[model samples]
Target: GGAGGGGGRNRGGPGGGPPKASGKKRHRLASLPPSALLARVERRGGGGSFPVHCVAGGKLLELNQRLALEPRLLYDRPCREGYVAILFPSPDAARQLRSRLLSESEYLRVRGLSAEDLL
Candidate 1:
C-alpha cells in the first residue's frame, strides 16, 4: 500500500500517511452545468455496473481522486475485460470511452449491439 498501486490517498486511506486535505472540494460535476451529468449518464459506458453522480464543475476532474471512490465492475464482467475501471464525469466522457471501445478490435464486435445478438 506504500505506492505500489496508484493514486495513493491524499494521506492514505484513513489509516496513516499525510493528514487528508481539510477543505479540498469534493468532485461535484452533477451540480455544475447540469447538462454535464446528464450527458455523462447518457453515454453507453455510464449504464454499466459502476456507480455515478453529478459533481459540480469548479473542481478539476482528475482521472484519479481520493474520495467518493464508488463501486467498479469486475474487469472480466461486461466491460474492461477485468482490467480497466473508469469513473466518468460527463456523458461525453462516457461516449469517448464508448467510442474507444467501439473502435478497438477486441471490443468492436461486441460494441453497440443488443444482448439478444450476443446470445
Candidate 2:
C-alpha cells in the first residue's frame, strides 16, 4: 500500500514533472482499511433505503438514513457524487489521506496493471 510507484513522476502536472517531495512523507491511500459496508446489498429503485455507517476507533458513526434517490448519480459522476461516505479523523488525517491518493497512471503502475486489465 505504499505510494512509491510511477517512478516518482507526477502525472497531470505542469510539464508532467516529478511530484514535489513534501517535508512529511507521503503514505498510500490503499493502506487504510476498506469500508465495512457490503456492496452487494439489495438496492431499491427510487431510493436506497440503506443505512451508511463509518467506523472509527471502535466507534460506529451512523451517517445518513438513506442514500440519494437517484443512485445513477453515483455512477455518472463518481468523484463528485458517488462516494458512500467520508471520514475525517482529524484535519491532519484528511490532509494525509489526500496526499496519498494515486494519480491515474500511478494507480495502474503500482499494481503492475493496466486499464485494460480492469475490463
Instruction: Give the RMSD in angstroms, all C-alphas superposed, for model 2.
Output: 17.1
TM values, all candidates: 0.21, 0.32
In the range 17-91, model 2's lDDT, one tens digit per residue, is 212222222342212233433222223332323322223321122222122344543333334454444433545
Kindly report which residue pairs in candidate 2 clash with one another. Answer: none
Candidate-wise lDDT, in order: 0.29, 0.36
lDDT accuracy of residue 110 in candidate 1: 47
Please give me the total number of clashing residue pairs in predicted model 2: 0
**Backbone clashes in each candidate structure, one number apiece?**
12, 0
Model 2 scores a C-alpha lDDT of: 0.36
The Cα error of candidate 2 at residue 49, in Å, is 13
Against the true structure, candidate 1 reaches a TM-score of 0.21
Candidate 1 lDDT by residue in tens digits, 1-119: 11112221121334332122222245442123322221111112333222222332222333323232421222112333221113334566555545544444444454544445333
